[model samples]
Target: MDINNALKADPAPLGLAGFGLTTFLLSFVNAGILSGSAVNVVMPLAFAYGGFAQLLTGAFEMRRGNTFGFTAFTSYGSFWFFYAFLVIFNDLKIISIPGKALGIALILWGLFTLYMWSGTFRLNLALFLTFLFLWLAFIVLGFGSYYSIIELTRLGGIFGFLTAFFAVYTSFGIVNNSLKPGTIPLGPAILK
Candidate 1:
């Protein structure tokens, strides 16, 4: 038996779902579809699916030797965990994070995501679009907080919703392609 030949399921779907669901839920809050207090509704999902499950997905991706999947899943997992902690803390009044601080964090994340977005040029269109929208979402959210603009936040929510939608679409593509190659088109890799 060749250990290298052992069957292992793809981890991308789980990672994408973790990202998509959490983004969708939080987008609702950001878009004002749900009250800001409704962030509580997202906390548990963030910890379970977005935090733990995506981290596990990243470990599996590492086992599969996919550096991008490993990095994206693990980093985003940590993002969800930290985000939940921040929300919970604020909800409980354990500490307060200034709007500027949150804005700075969002800007930093946007920069990081922008870097990742370039790498996705070598990937598929679906993933590339996902990162692109995500980057835009982060930028919009950052400016919203920094400027105290509700309209920007609402725009961010629209971009975030697109990001989540693309994530879900990419996840579906991964699963369907795995089950039956060419069953769903992810578009050709652009890099090469």
Candidate 2:
């Protein structure tokens, strides 16, 4: 079966929703709105929805020939998987990851996001804002963890909340538009 012809639905909404919800939950803990123990609930959700579901969405995007969606969904999905495993391993005492190392990893992710944000110019305002906030969140979180600064971490959490909001709004707009075209305005692309 030819996937390009067989797959018709847009998968971005699923990917965005998964990422947004997971980020929102984790950000709650990071922002100090919830206890760290809340991660016990978030871990499984990250593994199941954020990781697995986004991977599925990425595959669909590939079938649709959307390179940006494929990359974004797959990479972030892998990130969720990495996060879930990191927590699991730490809990099991299988391997210990230093805060500095985690911070460096996050900074690297931020670098990746920064480049990805450049691509959003050709997309829409929703994606532009989402990537912008996401990049900021990662950088702040990376610095916070690296320097053991609680305030930076909290600021990152605030950025994470903003990222999640835009992502969720984009997802909702996409889905709504699918059902009723022009029901939600995604705004014009910054680039022609």
Candidate 3:
């Protein structure tokens, strides 16, 4: 059996699932649905699914010549790793980060996502909306963290959940479509 043939599987579903699951857990924490020790749960998922899995997916996307997926997945994968590091540091008292600093970091990510979101206008509707929600979520979350505003943070969490939901749908759709071509519609491409 040719080893190359083993790598031909679609990577989008895996990438989307990683992003969706991690985002869902983190959003729940942000939404205050899980308090106290519950926040601890996201650390592992962030590093494993969001970080490593997405990074692998990005590598696969690169192999397929999907620059958009490669860039987005790898970038977000790195983001998750860094985020996990921050949490670990703070949790362990190795380094205490100010809320404003965290806000700044989040805002910077939002800025990057804004540009990515613009690019998504060329993709399908599901992907476009996913990036849209994610971009808004980062902005809202950053501002809320900076100002210690609970309501805005909650709103951001809501947006995060929306982002996750869309990601999940897109992932599953891709999976179904791959299994049986055109079985799931991802909507028309906006740019083509």
Better-scoring candidate (lDDT), 1 or 3: 1
Superposed by TM-score, candidate 2 places the C-alpha of residue 155 at a distance from the truth, in angstroms, of 0.4
Which residue runs does candidate 1 get wrong by more than 4 Å? 1-7
RMSD of 2: 1.7
lDDT of 3 by residue, 1-192 (tens): 885885788898998999999999999977778773665788899999999999999999999889999999999999999989988998999999898988888999999999998888878989988899999999999999899899888999999999999999999999998879988787776787
Q: Model 2: how far is 29 from its true place, Å?
A: 0.7
**Per-residue lDDT over 23-76 for candidate 1, one digit per residue giving the tens place of the 0 to 100 score:** 999999999899998989899999999899999999989999999889999999
How should the candidates be ordered by TM-score, best one leading?
2, 3, 1
> Candidate 1 clash total?
0
lDDT of 2 by residue, 1-192 (tens): 886555887999999999999999999998989987888889999999999999999999998899999999999999999999998998899999899999999999999999999999999999999999999999999999999999999999999999999999999999999899999998888999
What RMSD does model 1 have? 1.7
Candidate 1 is scored at a TM of 0.95
What is candidate 1's local distance difference test score? 0.92
Q: Could you say which candidate leads in lDDT?
A: 2
